[model samples]
Target: MVISTHKMVDCTSPVDAARLFNAFCIDNHNFMPKALPDFIKSVDVLHGESGTVGSIKQINYPEGRPYKYAKNRVDEIDVDKFYCKFTAEGDVILGNIEYAVYESTFEPLESGTHYTMVVHYHTKGDYVVKEDQVAVSKEHMKNMFDIASEYLVTNPQLYALKQ
Candidate 1:
């Protein structure tokens, strides 16, 4: 139960690359990741009901971090091209989470726009692996897609909103 999928592309627009990947996953509180010492109280959607789709959010897990109650479910929403697919339940980050899909695709690249990003997740655990563990879990999914494509390219305004 270890499935990892990550992809990235950019120039922008599937609605500004799905609103910069949904504001880099709900405005990650500056993100540090190491058990979050000083801060990192990110994740807030609270009750989504806008634009389109089933739109439902209520994720706020940062009590102590590490697989806390992370709720998410906006199954599939397609705004002409931009997309949002999710299916998180409780304990996130390598728990029984499945069907975590976030997608985008926009093309018009002669000098700009050409975004594409995807993440599909499915994993549950009891634990029991020996042989190489799928090449160290695909090198930790290429270091989590190179730290999420270097935090979406060094935080493009944390997914742009500067019009």
Candidate 2:
């Protein structure tokens, strides 16, 4: 079975939201480790090119985490739409989910932007996923987005373009 979860956040600038996502996709290695050192040790580009579609990321965690590291692939990216999709691979299972896809889209608002994030969960066969189980996974993903959003909102220079 498949399950999808979505959440949105309102921001003051579409550039901040879109660039925050671009940072998440590309500079996560630089920022995530700094922002979430307690949980993430480092994010290394294992294959392909950094920030490009089809690139693979190896996310490492500090000792004693459930999984030592998780691998994910960049599945889709639309600069025009300010959208991105990431597919979780080996050792990256969230709750009972066997496959997870995270898609983020930045929708422009009159004042700023509406950031919508969706996570599609594919379960391991033969059984059903309970409501609580899905909620747990969804909350986990939402918290992640919140953390990123807060970072961008608080530190606009992180996503600022270089001259």
Candidate 1 has which clashing residue pairs, if any? none
The digit string of per-residue lDDT tens for model 2 on 14-106 reads 445556666677677788887777778999989998778999989998888777888888899877777889988667575667877788777
Which candidate tops TM-score?
2
TM-score of each: 0.26, 0.79
Alpha-carbon RMSD, each predicted model: 15.5, 3.0
After superposing candidate 2, which stretches have Cα over 4 Å from the reference?
1-15, 94-96
For each of the candidates, give the backbone clash count: 0, 0
Roughly what TM-score does model 2 have, to 2 decimal places? 0.79
Off by over 4 Å in 1: 6-47, 51-54, 57-97, 103-112, 126-163
lDDT of 1 by residue, 54-131 (tens): 554544545665655555656665555545555656545453544455554544444334555555565556333333
| Least accurate 10 contiguous residues by lDDT in model 1 | 31-40
